[model samples]
Target: MIPSNKPFFDDTEIEYATASIQSGNIAGDGPFGRKLENKLSDYLECKHALLVNSCTSAIEISLFALGIGPGDEVICPSFGFVSVANAILQCGAKPVFAEIDYETMNLDPAHTEKQITTRTRAIILIHYAGMSCDLVSFSELKEKHGLYLIEDAAQALGSKLQGKALGTFGDSGCFSLHETKNLTCGEGGIFVTNDDNIAQQAEIIREKGTNRSSFLRREVQKYTWVGRGSSYILSDILAAVALAQFEKIEPILSSRTKIAEFYQNAFAPYNYITPPTIPDGCKPNWHLFALRINKLHRDIFLEKLKSKGIGASFHFVPLHSAPYSKTKLKGGNVSLPVTDRVASELIRIPIYPQLSNAEKESVVSSMEEVAEELGLE
Candidate 1:
């Protein structure tokens, strides 16, 4: 079967990881880790980049470093990964769910502005499917309200908007390097920021709320407990693997771009399905290719694809309607019309750098057949 997603890796990752292990520095923030961070900072053009264990950890650390806690409300799109809301809740903050624009599956700037209030401390903007949201409008809102902006750039490592990197626009940005992502280190993440104060605080928070980072630089005679923090650092071994993948980002993104273009062209003839839209001046990494079926049920389409040995799946279930968000966060009855519609109609097909041309043709042909069977075209 053609899998929904596959991470690309080769002997280069193995060699780097083996070297990291042999160097007796498999701990966090080692040489490999530092190198990876430097590479990320340089590529993203951000002042500081801190490696963390997961995107969730990066979000949590960013929240802590930004002084977001109890009594704060963070506005985020309900149609996204549960990790965003969970991280907010973990930091003693309330996650205010907002609607998304059906076109890009990213937060709707107008609707997001409506959710802001006196208690709203920040807005978490997710670059859904590696396509940027309306950063210009969001930046205006940030300036108007004097609020913090955090980017959930988990899928937007190489994506850009108006010539600026997606992760660099916000006060703090988080990225994922999970096995399923475009870049893979098996499991890892990074936190980035341009603010000097936030960077210093993030370092302290990542190092278990101590001054150890300073001590390592010999700026402090001894390290000690400094503030509230946790062990959010990524291991050197994982960093080595991530560095190997980082070196191949251009080729990886190029391969995915070609696959996305193929999908766009292949599905253009069918009026029953709508392919993802790329906004003006927004360059996507093509992390995922999600099609919105207007007539057929998404599940039926997915099952048909599966029966044809083509792996297809649905994306996120809206967080507001999720069990935890409903029962615990009292968001069960939230009315996010676009979020609900997109969640039900959207289906993800296989789009990975490792997907061969033959596999791509097979997937497209199978999808076309399924659409015909469903009387969609």
Candidate 2:
């Protein structure tokens, strides 16, 4: 069977990681870590970025740094990886689930406004499938409500909205270098922002809630516990691997884009299944190739594709329907029809950087055969 995803790397990645071991700085704070941070800051155009152990840690630190805790509510989309909602819940805050536009698969700002209560402190906007959300509308909502907007750019490495980088639009943004993301460190993440105050607090937050970063930089002689925090820093070896990936990001992004275009061109009979659409002024990373097929036969379609040795699968499950959110975050069976419908029907195809042209042809042929057999073509 064709693999669903494959991480791309060269001998460069191996050498960098090995060098970190030889340098005797396998710890969180090391030269390799600093090198990755500098490159990430430059690429994302953020002032101060801190590498972390995972994207979850990045979001958790951003929440704590922004002082979102008990009695706080963070607005977010109902449809996404549960981690985005998990971060707010981790901070002892409520995750107010908002609906999404099925086409864009992101938070609907209009619905978000209705969901926000007086206790709202922040908004976590995820760029679903690396397609930049309606940031202009989301930003307007943030300003009007005086709420802090946090960008969950986990899937959006090179994505931008109206020329501005996706992650930089909010008070704080988090990026994942997970094996599944556009960028990879195997398992790593980054926290980014231009704001000095938040950035300073984040360093403290990621370092076991101390001023250790300042001490490490020799700005302070001694460091002590200053607030509530945990060890969220990434290891130097991981940073080394991540840095090499960042350096060759252009090629990786181009390859992913090329595959996406190929799929678009081949799937031009778009009515059979809906494909992702990039709105005006947005440049998506094409992290995922999600198609909306007939909702009733979604499973049948998936099984057929799987039988054909195509690594096609379904997209995320709606968080609202999940046991945790149904019981805690939502506190009620709040029926989100759009999220429910999309979750049941969205099919994901292979779009990894190394996906070959021959594989693409085979995938398309298999899908067309499936559609014909189902009498839907």
Candidate 3:
């Protein structure tokens, strides 16, 4: 049976990983780790890139670096992964959930504006499925309100908007290199920023609130305890794997895009489901190929896929309506109609660079058969 997600790896990945082991520098920020930092900064075109342990840690550090602490609130979409909100909560801040645009499934700047209050200090924009949200509007909103813009670009390392990289558009951007992501290092992440101040602070925070980075650069005689911080560093072993993946980004992105396009063309004539949408000037990494089907038919459709030896699944449940959020939110229960609707209707198909042409065709064929059987066509 075809799985919903699988990591792609090659001989280069194994070779780099093995070399890292032989180098006897498996610690954090070693040679391979520094290489990854430089490579990612060059590729993302950001002034600074700090490798981290996980995307969750990347978000937490970004929040801490921006001074978003207790009594502050952050605006985020309820339709996204829970990490953004979890990061906010971890920093003793509140996450004010906002509505997402029905088409893009990204934070709607208009709705975001309404969610903002005096306590709101930042806005976390998540580029869902590696597709960018409306960058211009959010940038304007951040400036007008004097709020920090943090990008949860976990799925969008290679995605861009208006020819500019997605992560660079915000004050700080966090990216994941998890096994399931387009870019992988087994488990790792990156923190990016062009602002020198944020970059400096993030370095300290990532190194357990110490000035070790400065000491290493000869900027200081010795490192000392600094402010609030944590050990969010990614090891050289993982960095070695990530470096190999970075070198092959172009091919990985091309392979994924080819599959996505094939699926789009195959589903074009069917009104039974809607394919993924890409707004003008946006180039996605095709991290996920999600389709929208009738809410009523979603369950049976998933079951049919399973019976056909296909592993299909739905995306997130609206965070606002989650049992945990229902109890934690101060404002009783938040209402996000679009997020709720999309959560029930959306289904993600298997997508990975390693998927063969025949496997992709079979996935589409199985979906078509299921739709027909359900009288969706």
For lDDT, the strongest prediction is 1
Please give, for residues 1-377, the per-residue lDDT of candidate 1 as tens digits: 99989989999999999999999999888999999899999999999999999999999988999899999999998999989999999999999999999898999999999999999999999999999999999999999999999999999999999888889999999999998899989899999999999999999999999988788778999999999899998999999999999999999999999999999998898888888999899999999998899634688888889999988989888899888877788544589989989998998899998899999999999988888887887
- TM-score for candidate 1, residues paired by index: 0.98
True-vs-predicted CA distance for residue 205, candidate 2, Å: 0.7
If scored against the real structure, what TM-score would every candidate get? 0.98, 0.98, 0.98
For model 3, how does the per-residue alpha-carbon lDDT over 1-377 read when each residue is reduced to its tens digit?
99988888889989999999999999887888888899888888889999999999999999999999999999998888889989999999998999999899999999999988999999999999999999999999999999999999999989999878888999999999998999899889999999999999999999999988888788999999987799999989999999999988999999999989999999999998878889679999999999999899998989989998888999898888888888868862688899989999999999988888888988999988887788778
List per-candidate RMSD values in Å.
Answer: 1.0, 1.2, 1.0
Candidate 2 residues 67-127, lDDT tens each?
9999988888778888888888889998878889878888888888998889999989889
Overall lDDT per candidate, in order of appearance: 0.92, 0.87, 0.91
Scanning candidate 1 in windows of ten residues, the lowest lDDT window is: 324-333
Question: How many collisions per candidate?
Answer: 0, 0, 0
Best-first order by lDDT: 1, 3, 2
How many backbone clashes are present in model 2? 0
